[model samples]
Target chain A: MFQKTLTLVLVGVLFMGIATLTYGTFYDKGFAASVTGMMGLGDDEHGEDGDDD
Target chain B: MTKLRLPKAFELLLVWHGLLVGSYTIAYLTAEGAPVLHQFAGYSVLGLLAVRLTAALIAGVRPPWALPLPKASMWKNFGRKLAAGHFSALLGRTPFAPLSGLVILGTLVLVTLSGLAADWWEWEDLHEGLAESSLAVVLIHIAIVSFAPLLKRLNASRADAAATALPRNA
Candidate 1:
C-alpha cells in the first residue's frame, strides 16, 4: 500500500513538472521564469504583471 | 521477476488519479502567489473534474470509477464492528474512505465552480474560502486512506513481537 501511494505521488510530481515545463515553453517564459512565475515570485519581463487575468 | 501489470481500466484510473493529484497540488500551491500558474492549474482541475463526472455517468456509477458515496449499510456494518471491538475488521476498507472521498469531491466541485465564477463575478472571496477549507477535507481523506494500512502494519509488527517473545518466556 505504501509503495502504491508512493508511486502515485511520484507520478503526480512527474506530471506536474512536465506540465509546468510545457506551460513555460508554450509561453516562451523559459524554465526558471515559468517556475518562479508560476509561484508568483518572478519579475515581469513582458509588461505583464504575472497576475491571473 | 514478473512484470507488474495492471488492468487497462485500473491503469487509466491510476493516471487519472495521478493527474488530479498533480493538478490540485499545483492549484493549491500557486493560489496565493502565481496567478498564471494558478489559473492554469485551476483550469486543469476543472477539466479533470468534468472528465471524472462524465466517466461516472457513463460507467453507471460502479466501483473504482463511481462517485464515492458511502452507503448507509456500510456505516451500519462499520459501526457494528466497532461496537463489537473488532479492531482488525477496520484494518481494511471502511465506510470512512467513501465518506471522505464524497466530501472531497463535493468540496472540490464547489471550489472549482466558485473559482470559475470568480473570473467574472465577485466570487473571489468565496472561492478562496472554499479552497482554503477544502485543504482540511483533502488532509482528512489522506489520513483515512493511510490509517488502514498503517494500522495493519502496526498490528503485524505487534504480532511478530509477541511470537518472538513467547520463545523467550517459554
Candidate 2:
C-alpha cells in the first residue's frame, strides 16, 4: 500500500509538472512563473490576451 | 498458470478515481494565480464528473459506479455495531466513507458549475467559496481512508499481544 501510494504521488507530481510546462509554453509564460502561478504565489499579470478571463 | 484480472467495473472505477483526484488537486492548486491551468484542470474535473454521473445513471446502484449515498439501513447497522462495542468495525468499511464521498461529489459539482458560470457572469466569488469549502470534505475523506488501515494494524497487534498473554496466564 505504501508503494502504491508513493507511486501515485509521484505520478500526480509528474502530471502537475507537465501541466505547468504546457501552460507556460502555450501562454508564453516562463517556467518559473508557471510554477509560482500554479502555486498561487506569483505576481504576474493575468488575462492580458483576453483568454483567462 | 492463470492470470488474475480485476473486474472491468472495478478497473474503470480505479482509473476514474485516480483521474478525479489528479484533476481536483491541479484545479485546487492552480485556482489562485494560474488562470489558464486552473480553468484547464477545472474543466477536466467537470468532464470527469459528468462521465461519473452518467455511468452511475446507466449502471444503476451497483458497485464501482454506485452513487455514494449511504442507505439508512447501513447507517443503522453501523450504529448498532458501534453500540455493541465493536471497535473492529472501524477497521472495515464504514458508512462515513460513502457519506464523505457523496459530500465531496456534491461539493465538486457545485464548484464546477459555479466556476463555469463565473466565466461569463459574476459568480467567481461563489465558485471560490465552494472550492475552498470543498477542501474540508476532501481532507475528511482522506482521513477516513488513511486511518482505517492504521486502525486495522493496531487491532491486529493488540490481538496478537492478547494471545501471547493468554498463554502466559495459562
Candidate 3:
C-alpha cells in the first residue's frame, strides 16, 4: 500500500516534470502558455508567453 | 519478475513534451533562431503544464493510503536524502525530501514574482537582469526534477540487486 502511494506520488511528479520539461523548448510564444497552461521549468516565469488575455 | 505495469502511453506523451520543448528552449538562446518559432513552441509547452496541473489538482481529492515501510522513519529518511542534494540540509532530518518540496514551493513563488516583473516591475533598473536570473533558477529546477526519478530508480535497482546477490545454500 505504501509503495503504491509512493508510486502514485512519483507518477504525479513525473507528469509535471514532463510538462515543465517540454515547456522549456517553447514557452513564450503561445504554445507553452496555451497548451501547457504555463508549466514553468523549476524556476521559470512562464507568464508572458501564456494566457494573459 | 513482479511485472510492474506503468502508464507507458501517458509516460510517452510526457517524454515527447520534455524532449521537444526542452530542446527548443536550449537551442533558442544558445543557437539564435527565428522569434516566431519561440512563441509557438513556448506557449504549447505552457499549455502542457496547465494540463498536468489540472490533473494533479483533480487527483488531490482522492482517498489516501499508507506504506509499510517498516517504520515512519523511512519516509522521513527518504525526504532527508533529497534535501541534502538540494543544499538546504540545515533543516534537519529528511533533508532532501523537505528541501525538494521547499524548492518546488520556492519555484512556484519565484515564478509568480518573475512573471509579474516581466511586465510590471516598478524599479527602473535590473528588471531584465532579474528576469534572466529567474531563467537560471528554472533551468536548475528542471535539472533537479530530472535527477529525482533517475536517482530513485538507481536506488531501487541497487536494492533489488543486493537482495538477489545473497549466497544460497547448495
Best by DockQ: 1
- Cα lDDT tens digits, model 2, B16-131, are 77777888888888787777778888888899899999989988978879898889998898899999998777877889988998999999999999999999998988998999
- Candidate 3 chain A lowest-lDDT run of ten: A34-43
lDDT string, candidate 3, A1-53, tens digits: 22443455456445544554455445544344423433332223434458487
- Cα lDDT over the full model 3: 0.44
Q: Work out the TM-score per prediction.
A: 0.85, 0.81, 0.36
Candidate achieving higher lDDT, 1 or 2: 1
Give the C-alpha miss distance for residue B102 in model 2, angstroms: 0.7
Q: Is candidate 1 or candidate 2 better by DockQ?
A: 1
Candidate 3: regions farther than 4 A off? A1-53, B1-13, B16-33, B61-75, B78-131, B142-170
The 10 consecutive residues of candidate 1 chain A with the worst lDDT sum are A42-51
Pull out the clashing pairs in model 2.
none
Q: In model 2, what lDDT does residue A46 have?
A: 45
List each model's interface RMSD.
3.3, 2.8, 11.6
Could you tell me how far off, in angstroms, the CA of residue A3 lies in candidate 3 after the best superposition? 22
lDDT of 3 by residue, B44-107 (tens): 4444455545554565633211111123575666666666785333233333343443344344
Q: Any idea what lDDT model 1 has?
A: 0.81
